[model samples]
Target: MSGSPYAPHTASETTAMLDAIGVDSEEALFDIPESVRFDGEFGIDAKSEQAARRAVASTLADNDDLTEFLGRGHYDHYVPSVVDHLADRSEFITSYTQYQPEVAQGFLQALFEYQSMLVELTGLEVANCSMYDAATALGEAATLAERLRSISGTRVLVPDLLHEGRRGVLDNYVAGSDLTVETYPTADGNVDREALTEQVDETTAMVYAENPTVRGTIEEGLDTVGDLADEHDALFTLGTDIVALALLEEPASVGADVVVGDGSALGLGSAYGFGLGLFACRGDRELLRQVPGRLVGASEDSDDRRAYTLTLQTREQHIRRERATSNICSNQAWVALRTAMHVASLGPDGLVELANDSVRRARETAGRLDELTGVQAPVHDRHHFREFVARVDQPAEAIAADLEAEGYAVHAVGDHEIQVCVTEANEQALDGFVAAVSEVVR
Candidate 1:
């Protein structure tokens, strides 16, 4: 046997396996080009499991413990202990997509509740269990719009201030198709209605705008945008922050045909890379049929007892490739479960209060930072939710770097603009955050 404890087989066994594969040597089995293959021994020396764990832990401990104020697409939010406690259960954490409804009733129910919650929040008729993230959800929304025969257009119009990541993903999603992505101008930190009206034409399939824009300015005139979309016979896709939705007006109220956003703000505290995409649409049958991801529905079993099951699975795995609404094969069930638990725990009143508190902190912090001579309170003169842009005298990067050195993390959105995000979790850190900005500016 190999001396390494991690090795799964003896040397003799490996040689026998190679022989069975008709390869004389292990190196010969690999198809890697000889010119690029490594000739030297690996630098990592094998260590005991415990020693390896300790080494990794020690190295991770060296990372700076920075207080976060960053938010462009991601935010640092407080996750209630109950949310983690319930979501971390082995059953929920390890479970994959609930393929078998009988054994997956609990997960299906949770996801159904998640869909219901999103429907309520967005004022849409139906919602899917989950998507990869907000960016991907937006891409799916565009693709779904393109599929609708009534909305016969080959272009998707996006706000100029849309997050670059989301725009990039949209570009990639439509790259292989006949769709063309274009940007509408923004004025005073909101989508310029005149420009949008001028740009949207018979060639436009969908028009998307973020409520709380990437620059952290609350978008105004959503109803007007919707009207413009109607004039062009284009779908109005509204992208928003779920937490802010607790306090902001429903997209459907403003005539949104589709809603797409991140659900992570509820309780999925920043894992940086992980997020849950929230998607919902109007009650139209055609719209529901085109929505991506999986949908959980409550129904009566053969015994006439109440039960939950996967109702409409439109992804490639469930349906034929030619008819699948989306190629996405997986859903964010665990993250959606966490979101459901968190939203249920907060209830309606608590969610509204949490959103209000976040806005309060953003405004208070902006006011305090504005007191500094070199900084403007908010880059835009509109109400903001969890984040705001602070126009500083120094280069935004330098200010952000200095703040980082002092153990705080903030986003530099422009040459002289720093986007600061404040959530309920950062309530106690607000003053310290403002003080850090003051010091950095000085």
Candidate 2:
């Protein structure tokens, strides 16, 4: 009976529709053919707004939630106030796909800027409309590699230490398709280069690796992996962390045929969970055409002014099913907007500073925590980013629980090691984290 601007129908209208459907009551309509339906109220005392807010806050307050030191993929960082202010702008928030490109000039320009920023960031030639997240971008990149290889002996070699979620997404993408994935093992948290080299033959379609790996150490060398893939007549694909490009080597420059990642590192918020999946391909004309999703291009309108529009798309559903490379559409406009804004705001110097800050902060925290009685970060190397896996005396979950009880948020990677993220670890926070770990060593 509550009235709201977006609520469509009144109770009477719903009742009339139910009556037209010949169901005497709402509960009767839900009766299953083989099972009984039960009608009962959910047992809960309804509280007033103030009381409910207080209750919810009280429950949440019971837990110790503090500044975190964990970055196994998802990291907490500084998002500027302007992000929320701009995201709330009606045009950006209300936009759909780039279907009406002319009317949605702002949206198209934003997409164009995202592509440009990514291109500049990775040193890649062509970038596309964003994908759902980093994981699916890898899936689509796998498919692109297949198409480049013509998919006959479509075997992709993914290194161990790949995120399980990404692996699942790849499996889902290749399921019932001609392509297959072969996973190589890892040694010392890096890809087994010799095994990876041995695994590749003329039949291999692609080689994929994540930089600084998910566990926070450089692998059997992604650039070397790319070179091998090329030697084996395979496409070199990168499942990179986009933000890391600010500090590390650019995959595209390192011989990656295709580069893609979750650009959530670009100051986007967790509320924007469906992150910006950044993708870029080498400028080989065939390779560019084979890239999935649309690309917004700068063109001149009839009046000879610059205009943006969707120019290239290999999504088979757009042209012909068998001919399409993917089903991901004109995508993630608003999320990409957040990423683009963050990039523009930071520019080159600010971005490098941010990236360096993350690494320094993480190193400081890991070094401090390593001094704790029962905690150690076993893998200390020259090429680690803002995240490192820390081994604690207790199970990772229990350690995280103890930390949380002390009003700290820690990320658990596996059984005994938690991923200590350095994305937003300032000096004070790092010191506090070191102290917290010291206190929680029991």
Candidate 3:
């Protein structure tokens, strides 16, 4: 009686199927505990939409207003107002998958442009329209390495300092495969060339490294890492945000076979949990066929005018079916659009200036903090981008909590190492933050 009326099965048919499966009832098939099982009950009184909104707003208002210098992966950049104005147009925001090429030209073209920007930035030939976030994008890259016929190995090598979220996701992505994720050491917050060389051999399938690594040290020996991967016939994958790509070494030049990381760093500011994954790879035909998510391509229409359409869809929903490269059914098209819009607003010079500012701000802020009696700024002896780790005389956790009490937030990355990120958005509070840190440490 509780079954769907449109289920197409009569009571007798359902009973027969249940009997065939040796289950007395549908509930028997699910092992849900009785205590945790849902029961029809009016647990709370309903409220008007306005009343509900007011309650939520009041709850959110109770959150402390702390100036955040936290950036382990999530970052805050000032998004221009024009990005919001253009991206909010219902036509762009509400548009779903661009399946029908004829009516979806506008969104398809936007995605094409987004792909083009990534292609230009990464120096990789093909860039997908989007991915869920850096975690999933990294997961997809590991699997892509597994799928490539040219790369034959069971090991996926990642830096020892790789963020846990990315490592966890990569672990799950290859859970069903024969690939094993292993860690290589980092020297001075960068790739430990000798250690990495020892780890990557004929048994290695892929080598993954991040520029401006999680510890905020700008990598110095990427060329050697690339050459190492090449020597082993392993696919080299580089992870970085779009903003850093403008000023950092080009991924392709470093022999990166696949490029993946956060692309929303430009348009969306500080989505603590959410992200837009950037995925691109070399134009090798073998590599192109295995790229995940969607790739919007450009071409000429019947009228001889340029046109855009979904060039390659390797997700499960597409023609690939059971043999699909990935199960990524949806993409972050809207986020990609926003990023493209923000990048366009900045232009090349503006982007370069922002990238340069990141380096300068981090260096200057570190210098200011280093001046403190108990603080030794820049735990790593390498150039940093937008952030750096500082060694404090006090426990990093206590220092972080004290800073929060002082209305500032920073990451307690180690026992005495606290990571502070400075961006244009938080630059105004640097003096206050430094003063607070100076006070807190003593």
Cα TM-score per model: 0.89, 0.84, 0.89
**Who wins the lDDT comparison?**
3
lDDT of 3 by residue, 1-442 (tens): 3544347998899899999999999889989889989888776556666887899899989989999998877789999999999999998888788888888899998888888888899999999856888888999999989998998998999998999999999999999898999999988899998988888999899999999799888998698999999999899999998889999999999989888888888899987668798899998889878877787888788998988878766544568887888887777889999999999999999999999999999999999999998999999999999899999999999999999999999999999999999999999998899999999999
Worst 10 residues of 3 by lDDT: 1-10
Each prediction's whole-model lDDT (CA): 0.85, 0.75, 0.90
Error of 1 at 164 (Å): 1.0
lDDT of 2 by residue, 233-268 (tens): 888887666677787778776788787777876657
Supply candidate 1's per-residue lDDT for 327. Answer: 80
Clashing pairs in 2: 69-421, 70-421, 71-421, 191-220, 316-324
Weakest 10 consecutive residues, lDDT, candidate 2? 265-274
Tens digits of per-residue lDDT, candidate 1, 1-442, equal 2267967887799989998999898778789997998889877887888999999999989988988887887876788899999999998888877778788888988888888888899998888756788899999889988889889998999988888889999999888778999998999888999988899999999999998888777877799999888888899999987888888878988889888888887768888758888888986888767777788888888899999988766545556587788887767888888888999999999999988987788788889899998999788998988889999999999999999998899898899999988876666887788788888897
Predicted structure 1, TM vs. truth: 0.89
| Stretch of 10 with least lDDT, candidate 1 | 311-320
